[model samples]
Target: MQTIDMTEFQSIDLRIGTIVRAEDFAKTKKPAYKIWVDLGDLGIKKSSAQITFHYRPEELIGKQVLCVCNFAPKQIADFMSEVLVTGFSDIEGHIVLATGDKPIPNGAKLH
Candidate 1:
């Protein structure tokens, strides 16, 4: 693995946000969800998350999750994804969302 200095790690704008809305994204080649995250002062941001294999749209609401908020917006299909909802791959390759163990305020930095 490549080791990085603290500055490199600090440069990543990682934050926690609550999932306020989620819907099926049908226009994409792979199954994904169009999700809106409420990032407190940052306001609500849009994202396209490929978590359909392990999660349903309705179940995602109110879920607190980690996100990479500083990345440039990406256009996937017709959706312009703002923040990147972070997750890890399971043994079967399905994604499992990275979340806090307990409830936290929205837009909390991962320090």
Candidate 2:
């Protein structure tokens, strides 16, 4: 299997962020959501997530989730995705977000 060294893994800026906002992504070809996460000192960053199967906008608010903070901005349709909201797929192929069990401060680095 392909594996990255500690340095390479550390290079990925993964942090905890709270979902401040979420909504349906109507302009996209596939079903998705436009999510804005509050990353504390880093401020709020937006992302496009194909996680509609298991998540809804109202339910996502205040939810603390993991994020990849340093990726280059990507434009999906009309949205400029600023961060990657990390998650794993479920048994039925729906996304289950990567989140901490306990509420943690925003922008906390994931070690």
Candidate 3:
């Protein structure tokens, strides 16, 4: 794995956001969801997340998740993904969302 210094780590804009909407991305080559997150001060951002294996659309709403906000928007299929929904792969290869145990203010940066 590539290592990064604290300065580089700090440069990444990792913040908390609440999932406000989710839907299957019908046009994507891979199974994925087109999700919208409410990032408080940062406003709502859209992401193409490959989390359908472990998450259902109904269950994702209102869930607070971590996101990488500084990355440039990426295009997936016909959609423009504005942010990255960060997560880890489970033992079974399903994506498990990265989230805080306790509720924090939306758009709060990771320290």
Task: Indicate the worst ten consecutive residues by lDDT in candidate 3.
Answer: 23-32
Better of 2 and 3 by lDDT: 2
Rank candidates by lDDT, best first. 1, 2, 3
Give the number of the best model, judged by TM-score: 1
- Taking the tens digit of each residue's C-alpha lDDT, what string does model 2 give over 40-111? 999999999999998999999999999999999999998999999999988888899999999899999999
TM of each candidate vs. truth: 0.98, 0.97, 0.96
Q: Candidate 2: list runs displaced more than 4 Å.
A: none
Give the alpha carbon lDDT tens digit for every residue of 1-111 in model 1. Answer: 999999999999999999999999999998999999999999999999999999999999999999999999999999999999999999999999999999999999999
Please, what's the RMSD in Å of model 1?
Answer: 0.5
Evaluation by lDDT, superior candidate among 1 and 3:
1
lDDT of 1: 0.97
Q: Mind sharing the TM-score for model 2?
A: 0.97
- The lDDT for every candidate, in the order shown, is 0.97, 0.97, 0.96
Tens digit of lDDT per residue, candidate 3, span 1-111? 999999999999999999999999999988999999999999999999999999999999999999999999999999999999999999998899999999999999999
